[model samples]
Target: MHKIKRDDLVKVIAGKDRNKQGKVLNIDAKNNKVTVEGVNMITKHVKPSAGNQQGGIVQKEAAFDISNVMLVVNGTATRVGFEVKDGKKVRVAKATGKVID
Candidate 1:
């Protein structure tokens, strides 16, 4: 399993959003990018369509390099590490050495 997954809280470690924190909205492992809520905000210009009655400029979260974020556990920003417990691999928070689900 990947260290970072959906709904995970993460802190931006680099780029213009440095120090910002948000939940993981999506993950593109193949492209090595992740979309975080309220991070990497971008504007999209769209025309009115059946799906969007008043389509106009909209704000959305954009994907950024996964390496730019660190998983947050218990209000602490920590690196994730994999460890085997009871023959099952689990995520461990480096700062507290606590299991993350």
Candidate 2:
């Protein structure tokens, strides 16, 4: 299982958005990139479309390398590790030794 999942709160550890925290929006496992809410935003110019009547400049989240983000646990950024408990494999916070999932 991946340490980061959709809807997980994470902090950007590197890049222009470093130190910004946001929820995971999407993950592209094949490209090793993840999209975080309100992070790495890009502006796109689009003509009017059927779905969008006034499609002009739209701001949207952009994907960045997954390695640039760290999982946030208990309001602190921490590395994730896997452990088995009750025959179930779960994620643990390396800094706190607490189960993350």
Clashing pairs in 1: none
Alpha-carbon RMSD, candidate 2: 0.6
lDDT of 2 by residue, 1-101 (tens): 89999999999999999999999999999899999999999999989989999989999999999999999999999999999999999999999999998
lDDT of 1 by residue, 1-101 (tens): 99999999999999999999999999999999999999999999989999999999999999999999999998989999999999999999999999999
Per-residue lDDT of 29 in model 2: 92
Whole-model Cα lDDT of every candidate shown, in order: 0.96, 0.97
> RMSDs, each prediction?
0.7, 0.6
Stretches of candidate 2 above 4 Å error? none
| lDDT measured at residue 92 in model 1 versus the true structure, 0 to 100 | 97
Candidate 1 segments exceeding 4 Å error: none
